[model samples]
Target: MIRGIRGATTADRDDEKEILLSTESLLKEMILHNNISAENVASVFISATHDITSVFPAKALRGFEEWKYVPVMCMQELDVPHGLSRCIRVMIHYNTSTHQSDIKHIYMKNAVSLRPDLKK
Candidate 1:
């Protein structure tokens, strides 16, 4: 079955390094907690707040050699009023046997407020 794992995190600033590092960290944590492999991943969709225009968050995936085959895309998050800033969100679609309810969605940094109930 194809499952979508959600994760979000905030960068310290709109710097390229900050965006790339934070994205990598969040992706690592999500994969670690869920025991997911790049091979099973179908694709990844990343969206960043308007304030973050330094670079594309999907660029971070290039650091992972095994993820070379993983199709990834990047876009700007909707500019909702009072929405989180400097935030990057990711949705990873992959083949998995795990039930949707059991998937561990990761929220870090200022994004913890986005889903207080999932905070841990």
Candidate 2:
């Protein structure tokens, strides 16, 4: 079976280092909470708000030793009115037997407001 684990976080600023670090932190939390391994990840899709243009959030995944070969893509989030700013979101497609309701969706930093219901 296949499932998608979703996560989102906000960077302190638009700096490259901040973006990279923030993304890495969010991914780490997602992986830890879901007990996910790069080997089981089919793909990852990341998106950043228009205000965040310092670097591609997907670049953070390469920092994980086992995630270097994982397929990943990056894109800009739709600039919807009143949308969250400096936000990075990720959706990881994984090969797992876990039921949908059992999957953990992570929301951190200011992005917590984006999905208050999913906040742990």
lDDT of 2 by residue, 1-120 (tens): 889999999998999999999999999999999999889999999999999877888888888988988999999999999999899999999999999989999999998998888765
Task: Give me the runs in candidate 2 sitting further than 4 Å from their true place.
Answer: none
* TM-score of every candidate relative to the true structure: 0.97, 0.97
Model 1 agreement with the true structure over 1-120: per-residue lDDT tens digits: 999999999999999999999999999999999998999999999999999999999999889999999999999999999999999999999899999889999999999999988765
Candidate 1 similarity to native, TM-score: 0.97
When superposed on Cα atoms, how far off is each prediction in RMSD? Answer: 0.8, 0.8
State the number of backbone clashes in model 2: 0
Which window of ten consecutive residues has the lowest lDDT sum in model 2? 111-120
Model 1 residue 113 CA deviation in Å: 0.6
CA lDDT for candidate 1: 0.95
Colliding pairs, model 1: none
lDDT, residue 65, model 2: 89
